[model samples]
Target: MNGIILPVDKPAGWTSFDVVAKLRSGLRWRKVGHAGTLDPMATGLLIVLFGECTSSSDEFMDLGKQYRGVVKLGVTTSTDDLDGDIISERPVNWDEVLVRNIVSSFRGEILQRPPAISAIKVNGERSYKIARSGKELSLEPRPVKIHEITVVELSCPFVTIEVTCGKGTYIRSIARDIGELLGCGGSLAKLRRTSIGDYQVEDAWRIEDALRVPEFRGQR
Candidate 1:
């Protein structure tokens, strides 16, 4: 049995589970699993563990991650990203100076509330499942560290940002919290995971490409 580490560039519209399923089938290994979960609307690097490599999943999970994203101000969604129900919309006049200031405030330690429609478990059930059933899910704020946050570009309501943060930090939550700080509601318009610790997206193989490799096909 080979313990190979595969980095996959997950495309949008496919859940993390989808990627794992495809890898499992392609590699013919029932032991394949991913280090972290990325939402269907997001794309980028996913570290996949196969065969005997599954033992290293915890090491990859602890590594920091970097992401680039666009937050669309003036809109608030139930999920904090583009996938969920739109809760409200308001006018936003985002200038470079204003955006810079808001981005600055997010650096260092911060408390963030996870979106109601998230994978967080509450009372032994996923929060999103509870939220989708029309039940109110109240999530407590947790401490998260933002190592760095920079405003990459700005165009009216759309502000692009690059963020590097600790494990388990949610970029969507950062957008929503930043919007609150600026008095304009916001939600993630786009997101891409650029890197995870020392692993860059450039090194990741596409799912289709990984499937064609004979070494991957013989894992089962």
Candidate 2:
């Protein structure tokens, strides 16, 4: 294959690079790249590029994203997700009306602070690295547009939300902010990227299948 655009359903516990590396080694391709980075805890659509497609990464990355996630109210964590240590806890006494209002408040463009344990670079190092060194890491909030945010379900401490947002939007930050507004700390309990632009997870290849069929060519 000269150049191919592969949509992969990235499995949880595997970094985005892991997918590219696996495909690169298995397919015996020299150049391989990914459009976006999904955290180790996140699972869903990850666009993999090959050969000439590698050069068009930014075009794919700039597209909007959609995610379905669960936010745990009244609980805060180090990484803003279940993968981190507990930082704080509080009581939950919020109703559906209040929850809906709070979640929907984030629909428009807003300044969002990226998680400290993110891959974002600070100074000359990764923010997560500085945080791991036991030093304070300050990250400035930047503008991110959330096209839509709907409450899929609200069950006590867990609120399931589906989000459609532009680039640079952090679902973890939305979870944290939602918790804060409800007067209770919160963190992301679950997250799955369902789509990116027109690319859907349903059409993506599973890691196992992709590795098993290296010769399979996908739409570019």
Best by lDDT: 2
> What tens-digit string does per-residue lDDT give for candidate 2 at 41-117?
99999999999889999999899999999999999998999899999999999799999999999999899999999
Off by over 4 Å in 1: none
Name the lDDT value of residue 67 in candidate 1: 97
Shift in Å, residue 124, candidate 1:
1.5
| TM-score, predicted candidate 1 vs. hidden true structure | 0.96
Instruction: Give the Cα RMSD of candidate 1.
Output: 1.1
TM, every model = 0.96, 0.96
Deviation (Å) of 207 in candidate 2: 1.2
Relative to the true structure, how large is the alpha-carbon lDDT of every model?
0.88, 0.91
Query: What TM-score does candidate 2 get on C-alpha atoms?
Result: 0.96
